[model samples]
Target: MPRVGLFIPCYIDQFYPDVGLATLEVLEQHGCEVDYPAAQTCCGQPMANTGCTDAAVPLAERMINVFAPYDYVVAPSGSCVAMVREHYTDLLPLTNKLQEFQAKTFELCEFLTDVLKVDSISGSFPYKVGVHQSCHGLRELRLARSSETVGDDFDKARQLLKSLDGISFAELTRTDECCGFGGTFAVHEEAVSCMMGRDRLADHRAAGTEVLTAGDMSCLMHLNGLNQRHAQPFPVMHIAQILAGRQPEGITPVNSTDGSVA
Candidate 1:
């Protein structure tokens, strides 16, 4: 079994702790010796995305130092893993340490499918789900084929979800469109951000999905906020939560006006 370092994002740690717990549980069940460094915090994505490299450097160094010794470092968020794998080079001086850290970091689904060669999971998610392909996960990590790209395609998230019992995927019109929750982009450009989120939700609504699942909770947080604001029926969930067979707290099935599950 590999010694795994679980990198729970700062937002996940502070707000959606259940996602972190689900990630830990799922990895441990797969025969991994998982470790969580409580001192871990943000990967400095918010700061670095806003062009504040000065503020992000310390966080990057802290991350590398803490997880560098582990056999493998995995995170539930594709965006966070992208930060370490792609952006750490720009934030830190070019050295073997930086390259070593980047090489070992992986997104949870990628590690499961690519590294562990896991074809199926021991969980059941009996619901119609719409997959929201966050930008970093689709493009940076190549977890799924982008609709914009031309080639034979595959979807890692879809691959894992299909292995679960009684799980059906919704037919999304824009299969790989951005959910528009680009970390700081949401706060700085609220109007555009909300518009893109609304458009993404419309795609999910058209597919008649009962739940929205994605690799990144930040995208889900933005999308779910819009769902509640508009009184949409579906709930947003992390892929980890679904694969771990953990129902999110307070997520009841959407009911029709006549008080029946829709």
Candidate 2:
């Protein structure tokens, strides 16, 4: 069992702690020695995404120091992991330690599949699922083949979910479409973001998705806001939650009446 340092993103840490807990559950269940460093905080994705590399540097350095002792650093979020693996180049200079950190840090599914070599998970979800391919997960991490590229159909999320006892997937018209939650992108582009999110949800609804799941909760968070606000509501859960044997009961939905759900 590899000693895993669990890196929960800021949104998952603050808004959707359940997702973080589910990630820890799944890792440990699969024979990983997972530890949540209380000192852990945001991976500086927000600042860096907004062209504030200087502001993100301290957080990045701190993160490297905090998780250095562990054999591997894993996170439930692809975007956050992508920030460490890709964007750290801008925030910090190239060094042996930085390179080592980037190489070992992985998103939850990648860690399970690549490190653990787990092709199948002993879990089950009976509902039809629609997977929202997160931008960072698809593009940066290459967790799945993008629609823009012509290649064999391979999806890490689907691979694990397909192994479940009774679960089906919706063959979305656009499988690798972005959920319009690019961290600060959703805030700055609210109207476009809302429309894009609604379109993704509608695509899933048309394809008969009973439950919506994704590797990144930030994507699910944006979609769930629209999920609860819109007419056709469905349960939204993190992939880790399903992989950990937890059933979705609208875990990500907000009341949709106000901004009360923070």
Candidate 3:
């Protein structure tokens, strides 16, 4: 078993603790010796996204310091992992630590599909969901590549969801595109971001998708907020929670559920 360090991003840790929990459960179930370094943080995504490399250095240093010895640094968020894998090296030029850490870090889906070779998961959910590809996860990470058709083309989210007993999913028209929730880009370019989100929502509504799922809450929050604002009936969810066999609509982890629960 490999020693794994789970790096939950600041936003996910603060607002969506359940995503972290689900990631923990899934990793543990899959035989990884996972440990959470509480001091771990933002992965400097906000600063890096804002082009503030100077401000991000300390956070990058802190993260590298905490998880330096781990065999692998894993996170459920692609953007953050991409920051570590792709941008941190460029941003934190003074430190060899960022480069080393980036090499070791793996986005949850990438680890599952590439390292874990996971054909399926032990958990499941029963719902009609449309997957929203966080731009970084799908493109920056090359997560859903059709070129590498060696295995099931099993995206981590799709693979995990398929493990459920009665879950049925609806595929969206555009599988991998931006959800218009580009971190602070939404705030800076509000009109364009909203328009992009509206386009995404239109596809979800067309699919009659009950829950829109994605790896990043940033995207989900954007889509969900728009859903709420426009009085759209559908909801959004993180793939981690769905894979951990947790249900929405007031379903907590304490509930013991089995059978084809559609």
Candidate 4:
């Protein structure tokens, strides 16, 4: 079993402990000895995305120092992983330490497919769903190829969903488009952000999706917030929770009268 450092995003640590828990369970179940270093902090994505690049410097150094020697550093959130992968160089000069950290770090899906070579799992998610390809995961992580490959490709969520016995996933028209939850982009450009989400939700509605699934809860949470405000409802799940075959342990509220009532 390869020893790994698990980097839980701040959102996952605070709001979505289930996602972090599922990540731990999934990694450990597959024989990776995972440890959460106490000193771990935000990957500096919030400040970086807010255009505060310099403010992210200390956070970046902390992460680099804390996890550099691990066999791998895995993160559940694609957006956070993308920050380490894409924006690390933006903060400071490319030193050997930076290079070493970048090489060892991986997004959850990327690690599962590339390093673990895990094609399938022994789990289940019994929901009809729409997959919202997070912008960072799609654009930054480069998880899928937009080519003429004639077969089903396994992304992190879809591949894990394949393990389920009765879950059905639908292919959307714009499969890998953004959900408009680009960190600070959600607040800075609310109209465009929401318009993009409404468009994504329209497709899910058309497909009669019971759940809107993605690797990043940030995107799902943004969309879900909009949905809640408008009294429109749908379940948003992190891929980790979906893969671990865990559901929120109770009846979830649903909107009855459209946007008029919750």
The C-alpha local distance difference test score for the whole of candidate 1 amounts to: 0.88
lDDT of 4 by residue, 1-262 (tens): 8989999999889998988989999899888999999889999999987888889999999999999668999998788988998999999789999988988898887888889988887854555668788878777787664434455564666766776665677668777767777888888999999999888887787777777778888988888877666555777788887777776333342433342312
Identify the superior model by lDDT, candidate 3 or candidate 4: 4
lDDT of each: 0.88, 0.88, 0.78, 0.80
Poorly placed runs, candidate 1 (over 4 Å):
248-262
lDDT tens string, model 1, 1-262?
8999999998898899999999998899888999998778789999999999999999999999998779999999999999999899898899998999999999999999999988898766667789998899889999999988899889998988898766778998888888888988899999999999999999989998878999999999999999888754577789999988875444454333344653
* Residue 124 miss distance in model 3 (angstroms): 3.9
- Which segments of candidate 4 are over 4 A away from where they belong? 146-154, 230-232, 248-262
Task: State how far residue 40 of model 2 sits from its true place (Å).
Answer: 1.2
For candidate 1, the 10 contiguous residues with the lowest summed lDDT are: 253-262
Candidate 2 per-residue lDDT, tens place, 113-206, comes to: 8889899989557777898899999999999999889889888888899998667788898887778877888999999999999899989999
What C-alpha RMSD separates each model from the true structure?
A: 3.3, 6.4, 4.2, 5.3
What ranges in model 2 sit over 4 Å off? 250-262
